[model samples]
Target: MIEDIYEYADPRFRNLTLPNTQLERLYDGCRWAEGPVWFNDGGYLLWSDIPNQRILRWTPEQGVSVYRAASNFANGNTRDQQGRLVTCEHGTRRVTRTEPDGTITVLADAFDGKRLNSPNDVVVHRDGGVWFTDPTYGILSDYEGYQAEPEQAGRNVYRIDPHSGEVVCVADDFVQPNGLAFAPDGQTLYIADSARTHDPAAPHHIRAMEVVDGRWLGKSRVLAQIEPGIPDGLRVDVQGNIWTSAGDGIQCFDAQGTLLGKILLPEKVANLTFGGPRRNRLFITANTSLYLIHVAVAGAQYP
Candidate 1:
């Protein structure tokens, strides 16, 4: 059972996980599950089935349902400050938002008149500015999106101004920026560089940068080095620890870069988030299924 999958590196990790709760399989039958976001008001979870070009919903009572069909090969989903749905599209190669009235608005698609490679993952700050990662995975193959040459010279992480609607490249030196999360205080930004998938010699680590005046101030320093697999997606706990998806399972690291522990799973996890009533439930998006586990800590973001 998944309850027995816990492996502890430091003794403090034992306190974060419980011994009696079993991992629950919420749903299955997805091509590649990613970007899990929970709606507390509606009591449901929304996630992307990237290859299927759709977004799916999982509720406690109704089971699995189609939230949005023909999602433009959406890859990531998050709620903005006003509770709007912000998404990164692989096929459309853009970032979009679903307004309160159900109208779809394109948040970003191009920079400097050059089309983006493909928007992969997205996050929204309290100030309503949206940050996302642009990579070529969507345009490199048809499995995720259409095959085409990259219009932009380099794949970068960009930030869109909430008021001006201006998109600016916050960081562009990474080989591939996959996952990102802000600290509880919103002073630090953590990003995962999983370039090893394309270049075996590249580093598979998460980096931390100080956020200054809505821009990255200095060069990022290594936060944690993941082995056996790369860090795909991550989220921060209230205590500022990072819970990242790994090839084997979920790895937990402290704010000071200490490996706390790992919540092992049977499959490769792509992304995860803390949900449930009090944000104590950890929802995991693995290769083909969605899994959930209860935790003592709550997610730092969201209600």
Candidate 2:
């Protein structure tokens, strides 16, 4: 008997994912797969194989190829307003941007004159600010990055001023902030704390914060708690729904943070993003493979 992958908690979730549709396994053969980002302009998807220390690219025309070999153990990636590739490097312990000409520019590597622990995930705000999470996962072992002592006082979320080039800590109370994204309206930010991966008493939920004046974060509230696994990379759909990666698969939450449904996969999902021409294709990075499924929603495009 075939296992059912869709778990519908509400009637609306039935409309998001089709019951007859099949989830496609695109590629595999990685120690740890993560950070799937889609580029519509190129009609391809890029992701990191952290333990392999390389970034992989995939297209419908071509199956999979090495995008960057010496990737410095990159973790997360996103495109800026200018279409430049913004990435978080674990081995280097910094956030960087790949220019249009393929040149690399160091965006943020230290805070308060102290070296960063390890940049985990990143996203670009509508205001052109580069926001990212600094966690110690990369420095805790030699598997993904060089093991070393942390320099910063805590794992925090930071924002880089697009004009001034100054980095500021936006949130500093997280045990390990992993993934983040803004709502379609750009008025709210959702960040995931996967601290439960290290401590059972830590948060295993995602928090939603109102964007204050497009700069600061207002009072945050727990949006949803993940079970059987912690929340990792996340994305927001054009309809304002949140799609987050969890231990089992991807969890779908409505705008109000209600658990709508779940897409259960065989492997633990690390990250996900919407792609394809209409942005209806959901691309996921699981433990050692990349998966895709056609959904009824489109991803919110940031400017």
TM-score of each: 0.97, 0.98
Off by over 4 Å in 2: 1-3
Candidate 1 CA-lDDT value? 0.89
Sliding window of 10 residues with minimal summed lDDT for model 2: 1-10
- Report the C-alpha lDDT of model 1 over 197-301, residue by residue, as the tens digit: 788899799999888876553657999999879999999999899999998899999998999889999889999999999999999999999999999899997
Q: Which candidate's lDDT is highest?
A: 2
Candidate 2, residues 11-63: lDDT per residue as tens digits? 88888887778999999888899988889999999999999999999999989
Count of backbone clashes, every candidate in sequence: 0, 0
Alpha carbon RMSD to native, model 1: 1.6
